[model samples]
Target chain A: MAVAHAANDYRLGAQAVADGVYVFSGRNEHFTRDNGGNIVNTGFIVGTDAVIVIDTGPSLQYGEQQRKAIAAITRVPVRQVYVTHQHPDHYLGDAAYADASIAALPATISAIQTQGNALADNLYRLVGGWMAGTQSQSPTSTATPGVVEIGGRKLRLIGTAGHTAGDLMVYDEASRTLFAGDLVFHDRAPTTPNADLLQWLNALDQIRQIDFKVLVPGHGAVVRDASAIEQTRDYLQWLSTSLHTAAEQGRDMVEVMNQPLPERFQKLAVHDEEYRRSVSHLYPAIELTTLPRR
Target chain B: MSRARAALLVCALWCAGSLPAHAATAVDTPVDPLNSPSWQYMRQRFLGKDPMVFDARVQVQMPSAAEDQMQVPVHVSAPGLTDVVDVLVFADLNPLPKILRYQPTSAAPDIGFRFKVEQSTPVRAAMRTRDGVWHVGGAWLRASGGGCTAPSVGTGQGFWQDRLGEISARLWPQQPGLERLRLRMIHPMDTGLAAGIPVFHIDRIDMRASDGRLLASLQTYEPVSENPVISVDLQHSGPVRIDAHDIQGNRFAATVTP
Candidate 1:
């Protein structure tokens, strides 16, 4: 069993999930809205000699901080840093961990490079000093898959498209730890702006087949039960099916969002406040239900 | 010159005088930006949820067309002084109705500013006088879509902080006594629409005066630009400080010398 500590601070923590697998928490702090709050990037540090980082945080400064934390655990040189997907927070920090061979799916690399800088410029202007000068620095490795490694070992990148194009999750067989990136959310509702419901549900099915005991999601706390994955999958299944029906019934996006989640999965944690954004993004993807655009 | 030639020359002058300005020779119909539901709600409310302020007499000036919807610059100003109490600009059918709202607290009645236009939509600006009345003016702007869907620019991660200048107070006057000045800063009034690596949006922004007094507060949407720059006329001279805080507790402050 992984030891639980309140530590007061949300950013700092470490727990051994299995014999050789250790999970470290990240800074989950972010902006609050009229509805709820946003989940910032918090990744896991895996392995000893040949360490693999799950997801890089938001900026170069944050990336450096993540590296500093990983170094404290083990002095092993990081062999590879695998980004969960190509969002600014998860991948932009690639610069700080520049020495490590950065690896992610080709699509993720494209999303980061093509729209990365422009997005960063817009955010920097809005947040101002909160940007920490990360705005001015150019994105280090955009759309370039430096070290491409496909499915292997205790960890394998499973394709999940409901969240974003080229969204992938790392499955750890030894520890049964699925670093489900943004694929699974513990408490907060998942953002599906770039998602496809049908493909997302199928990805969930694929994730279910993995023999894992604990699931550490892209957002929220570490979920130690395999059922949590099933629950999230089921939620997506219900949402996708119901939303499709609703769309067919000529229901608007807001009505679809207002529609409550399945009572059975209500106990399963999801960020309900983020539903509007999810509906806005997923509706388009679901409405276009054909083949995966990517 | 002969009498016939003189008569012909007079006719030519009359024709020239009767014609409009070279640029005004052609007037193209404006496009509407609020085609989507999200944007439609925004434009309707901006004009005044009630009695709908419409700028009927004022002339609306915009480039007959625009290429970039993301950074399409919009300027709204009236040439003559009339019975104008307040001026509210609307990007008709934009997600937000009141794109720009101005009430003249100064001697000058003319007002001007810029905003991020969401789509190829009609942009309207209205002016209301001190007598509790409202007037409006409008133009069409051609903008691209997916600005709200577009990811936020810059580091959309971590707890970053900085200061921003205020439009109402952070103005440097060449002379003293309530200078009508314009100040702008970059910002993304994320409408909680765009999805980041971690799915979320920047929701709230709070602005305050140098002494930490309230100046202006606004709730933004994805319809606003990735980086939103707001311009406002101010009545102050000297070193003024402005602080802006986002919903994430990210704070920015700045000081300007007039």
Candidate 2:
């Protein structure tokens, strides 16, 4: 069925979040054949002489479609592509930017090199025919944490962890717009497959100090305020505290998973599924600590 | 009578005299059967030709699909079956079929643990009562596969090096005169299927009272998840001393009080 819809068009549209900065906000859903894994946010900044792309979508087709969307807006060639993290959804489309100098943090680059293929394979199984020729491509260069001017545009690359082992956030100095990767989920439930909750909270604290006019989260709608960051922090704190309490009580994994969610998080998209997945990922480690070593 | 008819009559008489009285009744087949390509072979290999029945009293609980294949939670309990001598848990389609063998010596025949599932398979729990009848219970679990073959996250990240052999435990009252002891240890439990990693896992564990009375014993295999955590119900509400050893001769011991 997915192959029959091989010509599936993402119909991606670029929304202007700031001057010369545009974001293609994806749907708040998981990977499926119908969505073609187009459930991640990606964007590009049009500089005076060139364009800088931030994070690619899932699958080669999505990336190609994103390039086309950018082309319709500006004729500026994409000079640099920044991969935010090692998550398959963010970096699996690296193959589309073969001509550009695709880059990520050093750790992220290594993770992509080591685990990218496996992650891509998993996505293929989840979305099926959408991943026809998509291949995991490691970043061609390393992105350090500092400001770098290119094509008359000043951009700052912030290197942080917690959402993953390596997460890179892009900040445009002129427009004062911050592209926060999976580190901040707005209305959607945050995924925690490789999360370090404490580290994530610390990273959020760091992000909160930044002065930005527009905040583009990795998922969900763009916001002008810090509500997304605060919401994410609150949900993560609740999740951490609840899991700690359950582990301290010596509750089994199944019981912890079946526990009712807070009424507030019930409104989040895919909250139940993401919460169960988080339990499976974080419960074992928490349980190991709650019961003291003898 | 002819020679052939006389011989056949003698054989029938011998078979009737040797068969047990319960054998007169037909053994009930499993309602769902948990049909798999490897079912017949695995059943014959594990249960042998012994008298067995698919009993509802033996409860095997697991999620319909594994959220994490590396650590699928499974709980097997036969509270209604008294004097359960041996309990065997296995996955029919797993490359390594046997999961663990649990002996509830002085404890209730109830266990909670985690294991790795290689693929979609029927996980079965067969408890042998004192009468030599094996009561079987099972559930079909769907997984994305590659659990046992994939290297453990902790091991790959070197998180278990310094913490190896560390034991953590807790005990609490579950019901009237019954206490539950939950414990975990740090180990990789690699299945040798992964590249460059050798076979390594905790092979055996013995739970006893502080005064040296055996409560239960468990023999685990590579299919057991990393840093194995297990909960067992005991009749006594007192301190429990757990002793365990891995295939590599590493020993660990801990004592916990309710």
Whose DockQ is greatest here? 2
Candidate 1 Cα errors over 4 Å, as ranges:
A1-11, A26-41, A44-48, A122-130, A135-154, A255-272, A284-294, B1-258
Candidate 2, residues A45-124, lDDT tens digits: the string is 99988899999889888888899999999999999999999998887777888999998999899998898898999899
**lDDT tens string, model 2, B200-244?**
999999999888999899999999999899988888878999999
Model 2 off-target regions past 4 Å? A1-6, B1-28, B48-68, B77-86, B128-135, B150-166, B174-176, B186-201, B245-252
The CAPRI class of candidate 2 is acceptable
List TM-scores of chain B, every candidate.
Answer: 0.57, 0.87
Model 1 residue B146 distance off true place after TM-score fit, in angstroms: 9.4
Candidate 2, residue A11: how far the Cα is off, in Å = 2.3
Cα error of candidate 2 at position A180, Å: 0.9
Model number with the top TM-score: 2
lDDT of 1 by residue, B1-258 (tens): 243244334433533453334324212211122133333344344433322223334545444333234444444556674655566556654554445444454323443333455556776655655544344455556554544345555435421223221222224343465443333434445555455433222344333446655443334434544444333334444444545545556555555554
A1-294, model 1: which lDDT tens digit per residue? 012112111243446666545565543433322111124545554554577777665555556656776777777667677777766656656676667677676677777767778766554533343345463223333323222332233465565566778877776655667778777766555656467667777777777777777778776678777655665676677667776786454343334556777567555444454554455455533433321111
Share of true Cα-Cα contacts across chains kept by each model: 0.00, 0.53
